[model samples]
Target: MTEPAPLNGFGPLISFILSISALRDWAKLLIIGSFFETCRRLLATVWSSTIDSFFLTASFEDHDDSYKWMMIWLSKQPSWKNVRNVNISTGERYSGNVPDSEGESDTSGMPKVCYLPALSGSYTLWYKYRWMRITRVSEPIPGWGPNHRDSLNISIFTRNHDILNTILQDAKKAYQDAQGSSITVYISDSANCWRELATRRKRPLDSIILDPGIRELVVEDAQDFLASKKWYAERGIPFRRGYLLYGAPGSGKTSLIHSIAGELELDVYIISLSRSGLDDTGLSELISDLPERCIALMEDIDAALHNSLSREDTPTPPNQTAEFIPSSPRTPTHTTSKVSLSGLLNALDGIGAQEGRILFATTNKYSSLDPALCRPGRMDLHVEFKLASRYQADELFKRFYLPSSPKTPADDDQEPKSNPAQSHLNGSICDGGSTDLIDLGVPDDVADSPPSSPSACSEKSERAALTYTGTRHRGHAPKLSSDQLSALAAQFASAIPEREVSMAALQGYLMSQKSRPSEAAREVSAWLQKELATKKAQNETKS
Candidate 1:
């Protein structure tokens, strides 16, 4: 009676399944599969542990300097030539050109291409007789939409950690060598992180047309400060220096800073105080995060804080009279910057401020700044950059028109002779000082002739082609010896009034007459007269 009751539910089904031979065989197969899977997992765990013990793994994030070093090193590896899967990058971060496989010159003005390991791909290469594996992975960053973070993982098949250090040293050396000719410029992002903006060619200190002894003073001071770190520490003073370059706009303040950075082999970190979303706390954080032995630039420092307070908020001078005050109701200039004067002061010399960093602040209005900001400990040295002087104008003109010196016989003897025709074609002298063009059947009349002008031209076109037209020309200047350049430079400087025009204006004037040094010197008085008259009229209008 109990069996009859159970058959109504599952009793009949269980009995039917147990009676089938195929069902029994299926159950046995399920048990066997489970056992094999367990064994496979156990073996995998053991294999992973063994590999980890013998392998050294290191990871480099894309944002870090080491990542760039590794990428450059990897690009030069012989293994990449044979690799089929790779990423082609034209970014400056990779540094140097990838050798063309077909040995053709790239004259297209395109950025150099580099081969990088593809994302999520594994690559193998040998380093110092040790097998190495590189894997580049990209992962989505949380809270950043559509933005991913890249990382490089390197696994070396060795038990010694010294091999990794050696590889890193080699990579770092290669990166330094590649970057030797340029200086890296960094700027802060909205997220308050320093990002590489560009790699500027190292501008020689001589190329900057500063007044005599001004360049020497700033450069020597910076060099001495950098070398006197131990002296500062011994005296219990912070190993930091600040320079205040206050004067006229376009007076080579920023250029001087850039040249100093290049001369000192230090990277430049530009601190934009008026940047959107940047506030007091952000500025302090940025300053604190600056690297040691780096240049921290804050340009237009006065403008950033000039309009921070309204006229009513600003304290009236003790010497001021009621009549001296402006009758018009003055409103503060609107700025996206939330940085205050106190915030900037603290950022410059706070306890958290980075040590050994050289800070450079430039301002067009020196007298407008608070005295506390220009104090000894904060500003240290205050260098005034007035408008361009006659010396600067003279030096600039010579630099613009002077040709590179010819090689001496001693220097020429060191170089091995290549192709005679090619050397002559490149303006080098062949036997009897004849050019390769003559041998190529070119007539002397055609070779020596100047560039031809258009047969038909309007009066406007002829005037536009004049040196004083204020239009830029790309033609090469006539090759002048040092003495000839000095004569032209002196004549040009005589026409330029001292401390009236900025170096930038003179450079612009020179750029317009790039191919006509003689014309530029002769027409300087006319250009200066027009420039000064225009400036006076503008000033009168403003008044």
Candidate 2:
């Protein structure tokens, strides 16, 4: 009775339990909903992966072409036959766009767009069917979509490898067209080395907090430089740029390089050739093996040379005859030995050093450098950071003081102009503007009057009175223009007497201007007089 044959094929029994039309409708809806949901999930996965991958497709002249015929012939010879990879995808079969997972058919009428996977090996084949499609074909247009057949095998394996000759050939043609002129070419030899020195600190970047205005300038230069490098890179030229920073000690030259690296998003490799034991061979090895796309620094080259020179003290005998001369050159005895100048020069830009390399050298004494080192062809650029001007003063002040300033306007009528003011602060202020006085607590009358010349302002008591805060503890102060104070800071920041002045002394001078109107003018005036005296003496010595 329980079985009654279990009502085999019980469609009639189920129909009696449930209405037939209703059941049929529910089943159809379930099947349709499942199909739509599955498609959506598949589409989403494909889009996610596409965003993470970047493909580079390039075309070049073939073996039969005049420019690449020799290269192709070389690749075919038994001795060099390994250069050609049958696995590479190439040929006329790919006259149309390469197929993608997505259904997009239009290629803007491009004849070929072959697909290249992220091939990691040194020798990859160029062929239509040999390559594996790592991506599903069920998504929207791929990142590098509408692939065509002009896909040529390119060498992404080694920088020195000749596989990219075609790309280079194309790049040269494109570059010439873009520039509308001929291009100069220079290739680094493969024999020189850049010796990187060890430093106590891993990164010499902490000083950026000391000078943010200069930091910003460094960033702007970095952006321009990187953009230029990229332009060259896309044209298949080796990417490189050179910079020279020369100035007084403590002028933030080294600090500036570090900030530039941080701003440009690059790694910095410091090569101190002065480390006592490096020689031509050692330097050459370092330069040849440098990691690509990193900074190479040769800090204080002048100092390095002086130290090197001091170590080579093989003086001539007072009355030695020609015959008495040693057959071999005598090695000088010194605390720390170094390579010769020729070695250093070769290391600067020898053919053996790595390509796409950036070199930065700093010196306190530019005049002392050999003509070859700082010349246009060697360094490409030489920038000098001079003594602070009035413009620089405003920069330093804005950098040091702006962070502590109030963000909102004191009065509702003055809507916040923080962004505009910040932008303006990067450059010079023509005259003491209305806002400058209001911030400084100057008399509104003085704020409204036309600003006087810096020298005249230095001479005027009222002008000094405008900046003084009256909290002076070091007693009588001097009157100084913003320009004069800036000059003093630049000149005396490294001076012997100014170096002796306690941080407290400097802070006292800066704080005194915050209160007591009577002596504000006198304090700045006296400070300016001493600073000008030092500056004049410096100019005379240089002259």
lDDT of 2 by residue, 1-543 (tens): 474556466887887756778888888899999999999999988885564243333334221122232223223223333333223344322212134336555434434343222222234434222221111111233233222222234323233324345545554444333222211111122223222221122333433433235555555655676668668777865455567776555456776776565544454666655555667787777766775666777777666645442334344445432222211121223435366677766766677766666777886555556666666535777766443443333333332222233333333333433444333322144332211222245465653454355443333334444665343232123444556555544443433232222222333444544322223333444665665577567656645
Candidate 1 regions off by >4 Å? 1-47, 100-106, 144-146, 309-332, 404-458, 462-469, 472-474
**Ten residues in a row with the worst lDDT in model 1?**
428-437
Query: Which residue pairs collide in model 1, if any?
Result: none
Q: What TM-score would every model get versus the actual structure? A: 0.78, 0.36
Estimate, for each residue in 1-543, the C-alpha lDDT of model 1 and write its tens digit. 455444466878888997899998998998999999999999999999999999999999987889988887887777767888989888887755366558665555578788888999999999889999999999987652236789999999999999999988988887888787899999998778788899998889889888878989999999999999999999999899999997776789989998998999999999988788889999999999988989999887666646652222345456542222212222226678898877878888988889999989987656556788888878999998778889999999988887756766654655556553333333322221112112223355543442233322222234334423345343357888778889999999988887778888899988877777997898889889988898678666646
Model 1 lDDT on a 0 to 1 scale: 0.78
